[model samples]
Target: MSSTTQTPEATVAVVGGRLVTPDSVIEGGVRIDGQEIAEVGDIDADAETVIDADGQLVLPGLVDLHGDDIEQHLQPRSGARMDASMALASADRANVAAGITTKFHAISFELDEETDRSPELAATMTDAIVDATDLLVDHRLHARCEVTQKRCVDAVLDVLDNGDADLVSVMSHIPGKGQFRDMAAFRSYYENSSNHTAEEAQEMIEERMSIPMETIRDRINRILDRAHERGVVTASHDDENPREVERLAESGVDITEYPITLETAQRASEVGMTTAMGAPNLVRGESQWGNLATIDGIEEGVVDTLVADYHPPSLLAAVFVETGESLPERVKRVSAAPADAAGFTERGRIQPDKRADLIVVDPEPTPTVTEAVVAGQPVYRADATTGESQ
Candidate 1:
């Protein structure tokens, strides 16, 4: 972040902010030369465009590795479906406004999913995400594979081979395992998440439990193999045991998303995998499903990245959560660490010659994204106080 850059020479410059670099924070500005960061700190030359970042914090834009907010956008209300393009647009704006420049939309292919997330809908959204070019943020796909469903496994494989999935994760959420270690909790989660009645939820849980462990492992292995072959980052969801984490790490998994226990998270870190937890968990101080707290993971040095999960804005809020760390360290969990976890190298840190993806944050009463810039372009601003500076 603190690089020895040349004299300021660029088309656009953001001036007068506490620039949070990797090493330290400085009261300076950043110069953007087209699509790259031309210079940082001590800019004196005039430019055609200038964003007045006075009294704010200028940090690299967040790179969210996984979020399911797109699904929420698609069905904002019950029993209704929005257009694919519209949903993508809304989600893009939401993420960018939340200071997220790089987003991995987690689309799940599951058996007992709601009506809005059919196989055809998943395919449509996949194509939509790929074909979209007018988005403000860099949108990528994270295909969530529910391995108990053959259709889900097959769909993820096709998407992976076609180069549509940037990140792939294997999810086997059968009862009495992982996130649902308690049988009563499994029934409650299934009954609440779908249209299934109590009896139906029980039946579905029993049916899923009947799926042989061998078959589930086989399906997960196939997905992991293809993901490795395609050179895409792979993740295991809601890991519960150290043994399971070790097995996934041996298989070359790059990340472990939301390990349910501290032991599992430590095992993931010991085996050389990036551990990610939900930003909301950090903001709310606990997991939504009564699992390991994100603060515990951060304090234990087990978690390396913070994802949006279902709440896009929580990422920005979590940054200023008083985690007993410097702002630069907390910022890296959402930006540099996540970018590295996802195998991206172009735009995480605010260094010279890196992609000029940045955000100006107002950290007073609440942490809010005042302006967001992606690829050297000013894509969003909270107000009109961003133009030429004298």
Candidate 2:
């Protein structure tokens, strides 16, 4: 009798790792046939290219809904701006290194905030995000409209009308409200942000406080309306209380990001709106503004998504922090949850027929991304070819 030999035909196989799926954790491997996953558990390890992930966790690539790190990359120092393409490329490397497969860059539009970088950068930044193909990770535009300024609203609406922005969020940062509820901290923060004198910062804060809520709401509604008509997702930032959450929910805001209080987050959840908190808040165990701690929302089951905010690494670090939840559930906070919140339906979980966007994580003394694969192609790989991290 003649026996025929079987050949492994997968493009790449990530083996010997605990796979964090959407609903469960499996002690097996995954195979990428091409751009999509072919097998989930007990995958054939003899593929053309095998990545041994023994003693590590194989997680879905992180989907960062809101990250301000792009701005920092654009302007590394006060009054010093780098080339837009170069800055975006740098941010892309940093994000993929942290296992972020999809990144929503937050572009703030404000008036009279010269040090916040020119509000004109909004159009330039949005164009860069849409046109750049050199970026390794998937990039989207998050238009952050500061409602106190009508020009800011106009700019964001134009982006929406042009179908350039993927997400839209309305925020009003008056000193006595929202995240700046602590007026002292607010003044101190403004003073420290630039060379502005205490008086100049106070003047700026007071100027914002003078804008009536009626005016702010009108500007906010216009942007929200345009965004909705364009089928773009909307969010309200730094909600202060349940009443405020209710108001935003009534306005058809689909998300509440960085709710300042636990009650606010709970109200958002109760009203069927998705709640997102910053990953830095969870990693730090408290809010910099002394607002509701992110753990409070996690313990209460209110937080539906965790964004990168100003720090991308915090997202990966948070999954290993032991939050009393299974690894699969905790992994969803950064991957599945944010991906769903951002309306990215195709590539958040590790499953057959899904896009092969995955990360090999070594969670020993800390969680570090060793290899990142997007669309079945390796984008980054650390020099761990010899040790157990291979």
Per-candidate TM-scores read: 0.94, 0.94
Model 2 regions more than 4 Å off: 1-10, 385-390
Reference-based lDDT, each prediction:
0.87, 0.85
Residues 200-299, model 2: lDDT tens digits: 9889787898898888888988998999999999999999999998988999999999999888898899999999998899999999889988888999
Judged by whole-model lDDT over C-alpha atoms, candidate 1 comes out at 0.87
**Where's the lowest-lDDT run of ten residues in candidate 1?**
1-10
What's the residue-level lDDT of 287 in candidate 1?
94
175-221 per-residue lDDT for model 1 (tens digits): 98888888889889868876668888878787889999999989989
Instruction: State the lDDT at 347 in candidate 1.
Output: 78
Clashing pairs in 2: 52-390
Which model scores highest in lDDT? 1
Per-prediction count of colliding residue pairs? 0, 1
